[model samples]
Target: MLKKLYGKLEISINALESWMKERKNLAGLLVGIVILGGLIGCAIWLNQPVEGEVPTSASQMAYEKASVTAVLEDGAVPDYEDAEGRRVGTQELEIRILTGTHKGEIMSLTNYMSALFNVDVEKGDQIIVRIMTDEDGSYYASLFNYNRGIVLGVFVLIFFILLAVLGGKKGLGALLGLLFTLASIWFVLIPCLIRGIPAIAATVGIVAVTAAGALVLLNGFSLKTLCSVLGCVIGVVAAGGIAALVGNITPMNGFNMPEAENLLLYGADKGMKISGLLVCGVLISALGAVMDVALGIASSIWELHEQNPSLPGRALFRSGMHIGRDAMGTMANTLILAFAGSSLNMLILVQTYDIPFIQLINTDYICIEIIQSVAGALGILLTVPIVAFISARLMARGKRVS
Candidate 1:
């Protein structure tokens, strides 16, 4: 009985040793995650309270407040309106400040006949208000945007907890992936962009770093991972080239991005290919899905070969194509739908104008988005065949050697 017990003990010890060897990197990842979580906690603490008072020379500022009552167009309406209409035709809000040095301030404001949006503002509603200083030396309300920091914080904390408790060591690897992605963006990609590196180049650099980091963490030096990496790089180059070509021919002006337009106006104060930037934008945006498709196809083929080591390379290639076809079909639609969802507002605008099919598709935004979607689709399309072909040869090398 003692010998049997000892034998069991030895087996358990060996298993534990083997597990530790595999998970040693995971321990380091957890320590890093804890450190990162602490840093994020510090950042959240710093953003709280959001500057006690809006500084002077402030173009606009908003704050949350409550009010006693509100009125609209010849009626003393209830503080809260169940079916609030538009802000128009001399509608006014009657409000009382709930907090701050301006507590108990009353305001009768014009609603300006604007349709009340999804998040409505009304008297007694805890709402944000833009501070406005009139020529008469008095401050008043202008506009408001919602404050959602607290909600966002709660969501983020819950997600982190989910990762830690549910995933344990694997969660730690995920956290490392997050850090890796962020660092690649901030250190490598952003710096490249700052140096005026071509956006495609910067983005490809970032994606390469991302692919390497993820593959190493998950698959180490395995042939599957290496093949996937090579396949992803090739796909990205092709995708970027396609995007650039399509974007150059498209009518979308360089100043299309609201934020980018403003930044360009500030940065150059003059001649910059706001349009060339658009080309880069399209390329960078689609590169991610391209990499994902490459990895998926390559890894699938590699795993198939691992499972059936007796299979020849040609057979494995065929099997990978089968997998790739199924993946490519859904993935192409998914990519297109993802882009469509983002441009739903643009589509709505086009519908509002009753634009003809030719005109609608010809629109710069539509054209630009098409280029992005097509580039991504083409890249994904190409990656499957490439990864399969490469992984097949590499996997076959093993069989030949054996």
Candidate 2:
């Protein structure tokens, strides 16, 4: 039994050593470690509490934690139509403060359920309450979001479990890459933007980092991964350039984007560039598709090279180009369909309004979607040849070395 266990361990170690024998693999491993470390650092930084005031002179205002003691069966659920003609309900509840200056105090609160913003509460439920004191010493408490940490935790656990079961080690790597990307967005990119960093520059930097991490994790430290990274970067740059050109040539400004007005209003004091941010948004949206195309083409070419190791660089490049052309058709349709799906509701609304084709096409939303789809498709097309050439050249060089 001892001999068998030792033999298996030796085999595993040997396999691992063989896998890391290549310098490229060692470098990729080091880069992955650095990215993961950066992600952890960002997580620690973002975990710190961020506090801000509402810029009010009211002295007695406070946010408190509370627990619902009772549902107040006497509460009336008045039937009413909201601005959207949708019916909503309201409920009153009795709650006891769990924390803050009002700890142990009982209060009657109203819960308004709207089609847009609402949360249901039950007995013993924990919630956040915003307590505001009037000039006359009277105080009121408003119900905020309930404590949904457990739900979120459960959702995340399920996701990881599914990923692990389906993907094994590869899935774990993908998860790590995903976490790193998200951390970069939430910690690095957003903070930089908030600090008045140029939106285009910050976005491009983050996109490049994300692409590198994802490609390396997915494809490992090989010529394929290198080719994918190069292709993805070029595709992202192309997409960003196209988006900028379109935004500049067209009358569409940042205001045409959803949440643009809100961002502008909030960041007015910070002087955030809403237009550049809008272009950044388009660039980010198209990046995923571009990366997908790049990796697919790179992997396909790498496999071709592996199968025909004797093939010259020119033959490999030609084969890659042929494969890329075939992939371009489906990938372009995929990008268009994805964009179209997201704008389906808006399209339906436009059709319902009986808008003319010319006018409909001229709409800001429609035009933005069109630009995103076209730019992403163009990026994919561009990435194919770039990846093919790079992968073929690298593979041929490696073959000669071997």
Candidate 3:
């Protein structure tokens, strides 16, 4: 009788534990759903057009997707003497509009192709046409460009499929997190900046929100997530601060950027702050690398603590530092290379002209690029220690209590 009672007790405890585990998982799912819904709501609210905001003239122009039903003529004139010569000519095409108000309308269009702006197309190729409406209710159409949307869509679909197949549940979470980050930037950050919010502050706020959301989605609400988020935010902010300081010292503001003139012309009257945009750019560019380092350190430390709960905080800290050091070199190099690759054209120009080193270093564009690369690398470097320290303390303390 005693033996039977003991077996029954053991089975009952096991069943209860399983039930509690399922309940916990269900609760987590509910929480995740609620959070996702809230984020979507906020994104929608932020994306709404602001009252009194004037639309650009370009927005009034209509572009429609169309297919080249027939290529009526192809005239090409090529320059033989110039090494960089390109074909410049025009093609007459009959197209059928596939979208917008003119859907299924067949029309003849002229496609002017030049060395600088060209879209070579064959029959059945999808393209975009610019439609201009006259006061008399008549419309004229011209070739704008090739409609590459379908191709881009296919590429993106493949990317998602691979991510899902390789990453499984975690991959889906990452996909959601990526969408959330994009929404935060497009809906929240851009609008805030347009509304004249301090660029640096708005960027920082958005970074923090995105970082928190992504980490939570990936790891759930946990000590490791907290540590990672905190470390990431601090590292990003530090990078921005460094960049800002350098910009101030060099007297290089956003006006020194290539697109500054256009921005000033178009956005200054719309209450956009231009001066801090440089720092804002630095923060955004460094965010991914910094976050990677922070999460890596925090997760490693947490796993170490889990494997050996009795490990002291100092020992965990050392392990995290070791892991961080291994990551630091490669991550820093990644940031520098990314910045350099973006400016490859300028580098080529300098080399082609055989520009003096002094002149090259003093150029505003080069200085800005250097500042961006250095600040980002420094951010990654600092993030390692910060995340290591935070994760070590938190994980070790949690272990002792448990």
Tell me the tens digit of each residue's lDDT in model 3 across 1-402: 999999999999989977977786687668767866876786687668779878898999999999999989989667555525666788889999999999999999888877668788899999999999999999989888888898999999999888878999888877877878887888778877776789999899889988988887777766788899999999999999999999999987787887888888988887888898889889989988998899999989888888899998899999999999999999999999998899899889989999999999999889888888899999999999999998888888865322
Arranged by lDDT with the best first, the candidates are 3, 2, 1
Summed over model 2, clashes come to 0
On lDDT, the candidate that comes out on top is 3
For each of the candidates, the C-alpha root-mean-square deviation to the true structure, in angstroms, is 7.5, 6.2, 3.0
Worst 10 residues of 1 by lDDT: 266-275
Pairs of residues clashing in candidate 2: none
Number of clashes found in candidate 1? 8
Q: For model 1, what is the error of residue 372's alpha carbon versus the real structure, in angstroms, after optimal superposition?
A: 0.8
Clashing pairs in 1: 87-111, 87-112, 87-113, 87-114, 88-112, 88-113, 254-274, 254-275
lDDT of residue 370 for candidate 1: 79
lDDT on C-alpha atoms for all candidate structures? 0.66, 0.79, 0.87
Ranking by TM-score: 3, 2, 1
Candidate 1 versus truth, CA RMSD in Å, comes to 7.5
User: What TM-score do all the candidates reach, one by one?
Assistant: 0.66, 0.78, 0.90
Question: What is the Å distance of residue 114 in model 2 from its true position?
Answer: 4.8
Candidate 2, position 400, lDDT: 35
